[model samples]
Target: MNLSFKKPSVDTCSKCDRINMKLKYAFVDQATNLKTLKEHQEAFKAAYEEKKANKQLAQSSEVVAVITFDLQQCLPTTYLQTNVAFYKRQLWTFNLTIHDLKTNKAFCYMWPECEGNRGANDIASCLYDFIINQLPNLHPNAKKLIMFSDSCFGQNKNSIVTTMLMLVTRLSPQLQFIEHKFLVPGHTHMEADTDHALIERIYTCQEIGTN
Candidate 1:
C-alpha cells in the first residue's frame, strides 16, 4: 500500500541540447581567445628584445654584412589573341653581408629575389654557402650572421627553412666559438636598412637600364 511508482528519468529535450551545445562553444571560444592573447604577448616581448639587440648592433662599429637576392620577370612582347604565355624570365639573387668594424661581426643577409617565381631552397642554400665559405674567409673574426628576407616564398618554404635551421643548429658548436647568431623576419625598417632596400634600388636601376 505504501509503495510508490518510480518516476521515469526525463530525457534531455532538443532545446536543452542546443543550450548545452552553445555553452560548450562559448567555453571553446573563450579558450581560443586566451591562447591568442598569450601568443601575442610572447611575440611582442620577443620583438622588443630583437629590436634592442639590433639597435645596439647597428650602432656598433663592428663589421656587418647585408645579403639579399632579387628576381626579375620579363614577358615577351607577343600580342597573341588567344592566351598569354609568361616566360620564366630571369632569377637574380644577391648576397650582401656587411661587417661592423669595431665588433668584427658580420650580421646581415639581404635577399630581394626571394619573392615571386624564385625557389626558397635556392635562397637558403645561397645564405648557407655564403656564411660557411664566403664570409668567414673575408673576416676571420666575424662571428654573427644576420639575415633579413621578405615574408615571401623563400621564408615560407618548409623544406628550405628547415634545412637552413638544421644547418645552423649543426654549426652551433663552431658558431658558438665565434658568437654567431642568425636573425630572420623582424621589423621591415631593420630589413630596409640592410640589403632589402639597397637591393630594390639596384634592381630598379638594372630594370631601367635593360628597358
Candidate 2:
C-alpha cells in the first residue's frame, strides 16, 4: 500500500459542485424577490387608509331597520290543552319588522323552522306574503325593504321555495325581493329588541287559554 492517501477526487464530484452552485443561485434569487420592509409598510398603509375611508363613509350613511320572523310550535300544554286539543302541537309563525329611524327604511320577514311541523318552504311563503302585502302597507314611505331569515330546508330548497319566491315577486312588483342581501346570519339579536318584543306580547295575550 502507498504511504500517502490521495484526497477525494473533485473531478468525480463535478455534478455535486454544480448542484451546490445552483442552490446558492436559487437562494439569492429568492431573497432578492422577497418584498422589502418599506414596500410592505406602504402596502399596509394603503390598505389601512382604504379601510378607514370606507368606515367613514359607512358611519356617515344612515343605518336602516331590519325585519325578521321566527316560527314556533305552540304545543298543547296543560293550559292550552282545552282549546287546542285536536293537534298535538299548533304551528305558529311570527312576523316581525324593524324600522331604522336614520334611513327611514324597513325590513320584515318570517323565520324558517329548524325542525318542526312547519317546513322551510311554508315559512318562506308566509314571509313573502308579509313582505309583499304587509310591509308596503306598514311603511308607505320606506325607501327600501330589508328582510332577514334563517337558512332552513324550506327556505333554501330549490324545488318549491324558489318557485314560491318567484311567484311572489311576480304577484307584487312593487316589493322587490333582493335575494343575496337578506339578514345577517346569527345576528337576529340586534333587531330582536324592536320587533320581537311586540310580537311576543301579542302572542302571549292571544294564547289559547288566556283571557
Identify the candidate with maximal TM-score: 1
Q: Name the weakest run of 10 consecutive residues (lDDT summed) in model 2.
A: 180-189
TM-scores, all models, native as reference: 0.41, 0.40
> Could you give candidate 1's per-residue lDDT for residues 3-95 as a string of tens digits?
888663323334334445655676666565665555655664575466456546645624443332322233222222233333434445444
Give stretches of model 1 more than 4 Å off.
1-49, 55-117, 142-159, 168-173, 177-187, 192-211
Off by over 4 Å in 2: 1-65, 73-117, 141-144, 155-159, 180-211
Model 1, residue 7: distance off in Å is: 77
After best superposition, candidate 1 residue 17: deviation in angstroms?
Answer: 39
Clashes of each: 30, 5
Q: List, residue by residue over 1-211, the lDDT tens digit for candidate 2.
A: 7688868321322333444565567666544334343344455455445434433443354332235444433322233535445655544443445443333444545443334346556655665666567655654544344443444445543457567666765676464543422222322232334445555556566775465
Model 2's TM-score against the true structure: 0.40
